[model samples]
Target: MKLRIAILGTRGIPNNYGGFEHISEYVSEGLVKKGHSVAVYNSHNHSYTASNWNGVDIVHCYDPEYLLGAAGQFAYDFNCIMDARKRKFDVVLIMGYTSSSIWGMLYPKNSAIITNMDGLEWKRSKYSKPVQRFLKYAEKLAVKYSGSYISDSRVIKTYLKDKYAIDSRYIPYGADLFTDFEREQFDQSALLKEDYFLLMARMEPENNIETILEGFSSSTSHKKFKVLGDTGNRFGKFITHKFKKDDRIQFKGPIFDNAAVRSLQNNSYLYFHGHSVGGTNPSLLEAMASEALIAAHDNPFNKSVLNADAFYFNNAAEVRHLVENVQRHDTEKTMVQNNLQKIQYQFNWEKVINEYEEFILECHKKNIHEKVIPGNR
Candidate 1:
């Protein structure tokens, strides 16, 4: 049956950046091809105005600068969901339940609400006490009201089950094959000239950027270290300045182009994933797909994503040891490649999108059946 679907959260369709935004674009396109009428709620800051975006409708949301971090995201997403309700969509998919739960709870019952509860946001050290409490409550309400819940990692699904008593469906992020141009497009000339290690991530405290920089700096090896992403905050600026004189460490700010990033990912000898929070990071998955020798933080979510194929480090010493010893193991590189192949095969966008299609169809059918059965007949 043809269904009108609306995707909420992360500024919609042409996805300039952010993982959730990319997922929304991909899934919306896929559903459109499958004959479903799709509409994505766009943020006011986006370049595109409310119009038809590749056969799908775009609904614009006003963006206010007063709110910051998760709070800002919540404000925008809450507005998107409220707008979706007025459209009378057959399915409304909301991403990140932290602030959007209030609107999800109010969405019409006939509109199948699918909430993508992105990996444990409340556990992050960044939020204030009241914000954390609000998120926790919002999470519970999201689970209670959502017709279906989606999680990207098994770890997240388990957390939802244990914490909210909600069984969430798992659909991991997908990967694209890197072409020759894509593999060589980024400005990696400096990196290629020296023996360099690569680290790419947002300069957030939870990502352990400081620890990685400190660990690499303390190492005796003359190898260069390239860190990607912006250093906008005080902590990030402090670290960048502290390591300014250190020729071995280079901090390259965020690169927007996918092909440019793919070049960096493919050329790097090793990829350092220092994220200490969240489940199934897209950067880590992208690196794995590129078959770079992976050195990741030792956490349940990291281990689960890498499937024990990559080396795990818990401290600076361990990171240093890996830098010194990583070159000695040729077999390890092959293993990384094998694991990358496995992940690529299993986590393709086509497969993930198809699974989502099935899930939504199942929910629609169930909803129809429930409505048909009269209690007082």
Candidate 2:
């Protein structure tokens, strides 16, 4: 059935931001190809100013985030939700509950609201205690207001079922296999294949970027440790100052070139995934798809996706040991191959899009049935 779907949350598509925006970009385009009319809500200042992208409608809402900082997100979300009210969408898929869930009461009453519960926002160390408490309440509000839910990781799905007693659909984020890039395409001529360590993530406390960098600094290996992501933020400044003495530790800032990044990941000696708070991270999946030997943070989210296919670490000391000791042995090859297999068979973008289409259609069907039968809701 043809459905009108409005995707809320995120700064909108073509993915200048993180995982949510990345998924939104692909899923929005994919749904359009499948004949669904899709609209994505974008912030006013988002670089992509076009009214439409890849056959999907782009609704630019007035966003004061650049001027207002974090508080601007709430206002932007309010605008998105309010605009969604007039679209008459069949399914309103909210990507995260961090700011949008508070306005849940105002969500269009006619739409079958489905929220993708992204990570445990309340547990992020970046937020103050009061903000964290509000996030906890926001989670509940999302659960209360949405007719259906999506858990992007199996671990997150379990948490939703155990905590809220709601059986959320387990739909993990996906990545495309990296095969088109040539080794020589790497922008940095100084870096050689498998000669440097790579860590790409936001400079957030919970991501344990400091812990990974600390381990690299302490390690005996002389290979360059390339840290990617915007380092202009407060924590980024502190981390840069603390590690300024180490010549091998290079902060390359944000690299948006997809081919360049994939080449780096594909050629890296080891990719350090330190995301401790999120569900199946897009970067982690990309690293796997690129066949990088992974050393992920010891958390249920990372562990579930990697299993015995990658090395695990918790502290600076462990990271140091791994940095110094881990060699590209046959076993390491097996681990890399295992991760690639996971990407091809399970976490591929095609499969993810198909699953989302099926899930959304099913929910729309149930919603129609509920409306037809009074009190069934």
TM-score of each: 0.92, 0.98
Q: What is candidate 2's lDDT per residue for 213-309, written digit by digit as tens?
A: 9999988998999999999999999999999999999999999988788888988999999999979999999999988999999999999999999
lDDT of 1 by residue, 1-377 (tens): 88888888676668766788878888898889999999888888788775887888888887663457545776787677667767868787887776678765567667777888897777777777887788788877888788788889889989888877878899888776665666566566634732578998877777877777777788887778888888887767988988888798988888777776766766676779998777677788778777677889999888887776888888888888887777726678776777678666877788988988988887777666766884511
Q: What is the Cα-based lDDT of residue 10 in candidate 2?
A: 92
Off by over 4 Å in 1: 66-72, 184-194, 374-377
Give the residue spans of candidate 2 off by over 4 A: 181-190
Top-lDDT structure, candidate number: 2
Cand. 2 Cα-lDDT = 0.93
Residue pairs clashing in model 1 are none
Model 1: lowest-lDDT 10 consecutive positions? 186-195
Question: How accurate locally, in lDDT, is each candidate?
Answer: 0.78, 0.93
